[model samples]
Target: MTTHPTGTREDWLKARLDLLKAEKELTRRSDEMAQRRQALPWVKVDKAYRFETEDGPATLADLFRGRSQLLVYHYMFGPDYTAGCATCSTIADGFNGFAVHLAHHGVMLSAVSRAPLAKIQAYKKRMGWTFPWASSSGGDFNFDFNVSFTEAQQRDGGIEYNYQREPAWTAQGIGDTMTKRGEGPVAENADMTGTDVATYTRERPGMSAFVREDGVVYHTYSAFARGLDGLWGMYQWLDRAPLGRNESGTWWRRHDEYERQA
Candidate 1:
């Protein structure tokens, strides 16, 4: 580090060196991320959560099927809730295409929700996703991980994280929103419909890598529902161009402002 000599030979040399150093730092960071990506965390699962797979009753371990690495997208499909979540849909659009090379890397991806198999299947067909999907209806898995919630809890109040429930208290902070009600256990102002910034607020769904040795399937790690956002980075390439395919590229208006492609 040197003082501002102002336009001397030293300044030019220092500037060039700074650029090179920045480039190297960026490269180093990228390399570090690559290592972390390869270093998938292993988790131990003891709870036997229930789910509806393409077949029948499925345990949490059943999700992994035969793959060593599993990824589950937390889809929004509460049974009584008819429409899929808009934000979830946007994320799904980003996930339209797969590289087909994930399996070679030993990662299998799927989507899961609390909806019935029929509902999940219908949405998958509408979205044109070939990715695997499952339903969690029997247990509190959705509520447990904070993906879905009961109307009383969601309306009366609760924040669904990962897949568990946290009562909405209101010290006016993280776990204290309900305290703002100035009444009792639940807050009056506490919103039933969740906040706007909760785009990524859903818990990271579970992704587990199971290893079976001596006839026992041990739990490795089950990932979050929302952590799959990066798989569709290819969508970023579209923003470079202009509005093609009738405003598909335009952020000027919302999805509803125009009609669906008929």
Candidate 2:
């Protein structure tokens, strides 16, 4: 009655054992990549970046919170948006649980966005998330980190993200130059955030790492696009599922949205 391949227990075990060998090799390669990532040189951060926190104004170094290291998730909540990006929100849901463990290990984790502090706080409360989220409103932190862009940049082909120059959205078939078809992941995500494609695409999702030593902060690492796959906890579980991701299109929502849909 099933469409999938039928196998006896012995057949299943043999196939699973072969998969286990590949899985172990992948794990070994992952470990080697982490070592190489750690060996990358740290770049000194000379700019004085500031942020608005629940406790008040804070600097990039203050985000470490007496720890030597800081991890910032570049959440895509542009100032004009009424809400956070649905995908970023899903990734952040895992943060509330592990942030405490990281703090105990001498590393502080926080999320930074260009939205105002008040907006961030309202959304945080709505999501019931207690993890540290900060506001970089009116600051160049997001732009400097290459996660936020301006309209001119979008139109003039000046935007660069994921470590490469991006073709201007104007030149693309979507955004302002094209009619809204209300289709595809980008358009759907733009609708979810209550913004046009141009505005939604202006902000990207990524993570950055910093370390403070001898009273100076240095940028250690950053990852964008698919590079962030490891941090999306749900995907790790889905990868082990029988159907393995089973994705067709934008199939996820903010965790709370599912409750409303139900």
Candidate 3:
């Protein structure tokens, strides 16, 4: 016998109707939140940052690619890692499908990582992805964005992420902070990426948005951690399923990792 509860069609209809009301309320709240997000003031970017792209060296503004807006995915491919983060890769797998649509709508979407361009190129080819991936190797772009941390920052617990400073380490433990997260995901993802825990923990996944107007680039907004839940296309689909996310742990892998089974 199935463990799931069985119910009559009428019962399901009554329950679903109640859920529908809440869902509609959530939809209204979501629309209001989006408007508030767009109302945020844009901060002008005056720093001279550079990135290595397939077309050659490019500046932050150049990433616009003639579009008025730019969306950058802060891919967690640290300089020392042998592979990109599986979680980030899973998120990126959906990018290729919608990237062109966004481009046509006057937005340029790209990924930035700290790995060397050659390493990034090799991996991108392995994944069969064509989206524009740029290398920030030897640049302060990642550091300035607070997505990448230094060794000292890790040791001292001085990293600031999600616009807040992480708690200092005490004899009790790493205090109330989401940065460390847990050893399970951290160690598992680190081993998958072929790097030590420290190396993997130094990098985190994030996304940033910028707009260019009147020849000035302005940093519009950024999201990290759970803030990026909306962008994970797989989760968006899974959420509608009967079981929802149906997740317990790190149950995903790089897209290519599953190819052999097919």
lDDT of prediction 3: 0.89
Clashing residue pairs, backbone N/CA/C < 3 A, model 3: none
lDDT of 1 at 110: 66
lDDT per prediction?
A: 0.54, 0.90, 0.89
Each candidate's clash count: 28, 0, 0
**How many backbone overlaps does candidate 1 show?**
28
Query: Could you tell me the lDDT of residue 190 within candidate 3?
Result: 86
lDDT tens digits by residue: candidate 2, 173-242: 2343232443577777888999988888889999999999999999999999889999999999999998
Residue-level lDDT of model 1, residues 1-262, one tens digit each, is 6563558798889997998898899889979976775576544555677888777878766666665656666766556545455445556664446524654566666677776888888767766677667887667766655555444444344665544556543234334442332332122111221322122223233333454434344544344444543443434454334442233222222134246532
Order of candidate numbers by lDDT, starting with the best: 2, 3, 1
**How many backbone overlaps does candidate 2 show?**
0
The root-mean-square deviation over C-alpha atoms between each candidate and the true structure, in angstroms, is 9.0, 2.3, 2.4
Q: RMSD (Cα, Å) of candidate 3?
A: 2.4
Give lDDT tens digits, candidate 3, residues 1-262.
9888889999999999999999999999999998988899999998999999999999999999999999999999999999999999999999999999999999999999999999999999999999999999999999989899997887797889888777654433334243244456666788889997767878888999999999999998899989999999999999999899898667788987877635
Better of 1 and 3 by TM-score: 3
Identify the candidate with maximal TM-score.
2
